[model samples]
Target: MSQSATTTQNPRNPDRHQGLANGGTTFAGVLLAVTGLLSIFRGIMGIAKNDVFVATKDYVFRWDLTGWGWMHLILGLLVFLVGLALLKAAPAWARTAGVVLASLALIVNFLSLPWHPLWSLILVALYAFIIWALCTVKRGHT
Candidate 1:
């Protein structure tokens, strides 16, 4: 029966209920989480099965598949955690980090294209969208 009783406002940042309230941030977060999980799975595959990816010839970005796996694993975890943060009443830092992480994701996915063309491209697209969403959020609003 009291206003404070049912309010979902976070005690730390009471200006808004959540950054996700605007929808874009929430959507971005969801996308980030999905992409992160996908990357994680791909990383596991790469690390567990070195033969999973075809070795390329004359590729400028050639490298060990296992190495790529480790990169994906670490980056994916960071992206996923940041995305989760955005979904809540996250601070401004999360948005900034999301942009950074998504940019890095774009680079990683792009570089790994030789190994998994389709998935890498798909991830690249997803990361692009995530960047847009995170960037579009209004300043001082979330």
Candidate 2:
């Protein structure tokens, strides 16, 4: 068989495409970890009733600060773990997990916009970058 046919036929061929370089993956991993850490800190602040966050009145998405705190804490932990995983020689599943977690983080930060407008906006942008980086990998590149 020709080289091309042989490579195509072998599912586990090393010549198979593996999307994204080590650098890109590493960047995404670092970003995820940092973002996750920030979220965790934000969660703790919210839970502790820190005066840093402004109280919003009459907002449609109004949720108890404590409730949001717990939400962020749990979600942040998950994201952080996923980020750690990505830092290693992550598998395909890790990439998918990273994308999912980043998207969730973006939503969570958006919901928190009223409390800390600038910080929330920054996080939203960061998460967007993480999502983009994770999703930019071509299919076939591991």
Candidate 3:
């Protein structure tokens, strides 16, 4: 068969492939944005010295609540910006940034377990999903 014939028969043009990829990217972007916002709120709570969180004493990874708060606030802002970028344009760099930020968020959440176990776990799960979504997209297919 001719190469042109094969290409035409496949019915998977770049547009269609990109559309398929966009679906996943869009979902990931939304999830990342939501997660970032949540992180920001958590950071604010901590920075404000709100009584919402309780840190376990003598936890090996323990950090000053305010310090963690600052970390979350900054990380959350970065995540939020990357998420927005992905939503607007699913560029390769955006995907990379998403994965990196998601990984960082996962680590932060893990360390935060002692402060808020349930919430931290939930964020951890969300970050994992974001990472999966970002990584699963085939390179050059997007």
- Could you tally the backbone clashes for each prediction? 0, 4, 0
Give lDDT tens digits, candidate 3, residues 28-86: 89989988888898899889984677867789986789999999999999999999998
Whichever of 1 and 3 has more lDDT, that candidate is 3
Clashing pairs for model 2 are: 17-140, 18-141, 18-142, 19-141
| Winner on lDDT (2 vs 3) | 3
Q: RMSD of each candidate?
A: 7.7, 6.5, 4.7
1-111: candidate 1 lDDT, tens digit per residue: 576754645465543534544576788889888888887887898899999889789789878899998899889999999989988869989989999999999999899
Model 1 TM-score, 2 decimals: 0.82
The per-residue C-alpha lDDT of model 2 at residue 57 equals: 86
Q: Against the true structure, what is each candidate's TM-score?
A: 0.82, 0.80, 0.81
What order do you get sorting by TM-score, best first? 1, 3, 2
User: Per-residue lDDT tens digits of candidate 2, residues 26-67?
Assistant: 788988888778778878988998575788887779888888
Q: What are the lDDT scores of the predictions, listed in order? A: 0.84, 0.81, 0.85
Q: List the candidate 1 regions with Cα displacement exceeding 4 Å.
A: 1-21
Query: Between 2 and 3, whose TM-score is larger?
Result: 3
* C-alpha lDDT (0 to 100) for residue 94 of candidate 3: 93
Q: By summed lDDT, which 10 consecutive residues of candidate 1 come out lowest? A: 13-22
